[model samples]
Target: MSNNIKNIVYRTLSKAWATLLEINYDYRFKDGTWKRISRESYDRGHGTGILLYNVDKGTIILTKQFRMPIYHTNKDEAMSIEVCAGAIDDNDLPESTIIREVEEEVGYLVKDVKKVMETYMSPGALTEKMYLYVAPYSEEMKVNEGGGLASEHEEIEVMEIPFSKALEMMVSGEILDAKTVILLQYAQINDLIKNRE
Candidate 1:
């Protein structure tokens, strides 16, 4: 390794991510002493999404929403079943994002969203990462639709699929989305949503 040829990791002085057809295009800027190099790197963005699992009833709350990106390729296959998740809004905490999104999308307040795993949502062209979690809840917890803003173009529909049925969906290709499949199987394998009180 040459001394001058520093393999220094480019630090983002500032950046902005625009949602392009349900994907994030993050533009970041790195500052050097001599000049600024706008390095284009994939972040695999760190965001939070939760799988609401009910142990006593063995059920998991989910959402049925339309995804534009998939619809573009599939044409007719736009709507999807997914766990509640959203990007970590600029400088916003993952916890905050989950709490807010839960209320807005599926109407749940996930208190202890146990960290499940972190992985890239897509690795080929775009740089995006996801922090998957399990949000445990019961009758005592608050769950209600927060009604998305019409001005922002959000039309989210909520669904409560049984744990077994959710698993079936994963196997039968009904719940084909990556995050939804991952969370469902992960819960089943870990016994996170077993029928227990």
Candidate 2:
């Protein structure tokens, strides 16, 4: 939490976890007049996270997992070609949540989690914050036989694909995760990714 965030006026407009609406009242100093300003009511939502890594001899490790919401929209049984990501659950620390999610979705421990980008997943009406994390592959990283816990009812598949192929997938529009695109773009700028040949 930064100093700027410590004093933002928060007023609740609606109450719902999925669609929490609120307004931030701001007091601005303008030409000897203290003005009371307000922005439109927006929803507050849990944040998203991501993890990226390179491994397996020029391969970028990825996950092929099932997403019920995505499957519901596309009318597909399983949603594949997703990056390792998850939503921050109920006050869960961003680092810890992403670490757990990365392990569950891809079966590996990522090192050097770096905060890449933070933006709204959907800002039109639904307020979802997305945090992008980048990591380097370490030799000690191992993939154990683990899908998300059955009680949590998660079924994930882990895979490693050549970096070039991963870029192709992105180009062909196979990788559709919102956070994935943002992270991939950041990786490209930061030279975490190899140029596509």
Candidate 3:
């Protein structure tokens, strides 16, 4: 693999909330030839997402918010329904980041969370690894009214829906986010909801 890589050059395209770079590289083909390629990649760092479930209620917590990128591409479908998620800051681990995001986005203070999976959300054009988690929540965990942080322009609307209904939405395309869909499917396939009941 090392011998196949000839050269790699990274050029910065933008450095806003996320860093965008134009990558130029040379690869040695199997037929003993070299090919140059250029690709653009967005680096937003790693992130964490959590699916909060209430076993007694047979429901899961979700959040709705406007995504500008989605809005620009599909005006009709601007708002996204997603599980509680946030980018992991430099100082915090994935576990702590998701815990804090859960409380801030859904008003649930979860102490025990299980890390289920790790995935590269969009490896083709973005450099972001998402740590997926699941946590149990009860009524007592709701200590505050969570709508996300106003300073970050997060206007999230918390929603609690039955696990079955969330599955239906996933099939019907109402729930479009990739990470959210993965967690919901994981919950169903693993009988997480049924076991709770």
TM-score of each: 0.75, 0.71, 0.97
Poorest 10 consecutive residues by lDDT, candidate 1:
19-28
Name the Cα RMSD for model 1: 7.3
* Alpha-carbon lDDT of model 1: 0.72
As for lDDT, the candidate ahead, 1 or 3, is: 3
The clash tally of candidate 3 reads 0
Candidate 3, residues 1-197: lDDT per residue as tens digits?
99998689999999998899999999998998999999999999999999998888899999999999999999777889999999999979999999999989889899999999999999999899999999999998998989999998899999998998999889999999999999999999998885332
Per-residue lDDT, model 3, residue 98, is 96
Clashes of each: 6, 0, 0
Runs in model 3 lying further than 4 Å from the true structure: 195-197
* lDDT, each prediction: 0.72, 0.67, 0.93
Candidate 1 residue-wise lDDT at 176: 80
What digit string (tens of lDDT, one per residue) describes model 1 on residues 120-160?
87666456778888887776676665455567687878776
Q: Which residue runs of candidate 1 sit more than 4 Å off their true CA positions? A: 1-45, 195-197
Taking the tens digit of each residue's C-alpha lDDT, what string does model 2 give over 1-197?
A: 14222235766665654544455544535344445555554555456466466643556667777777777778553567766777788888777888888777666776558887788776765666777787866446767754666777777676667667777788988888777777777776777766543
RMSD of each candidate relative to the true structure: 7.3, 5.4, 1.5
In model 3, the Cα lDDT at residue 7 comes to 82
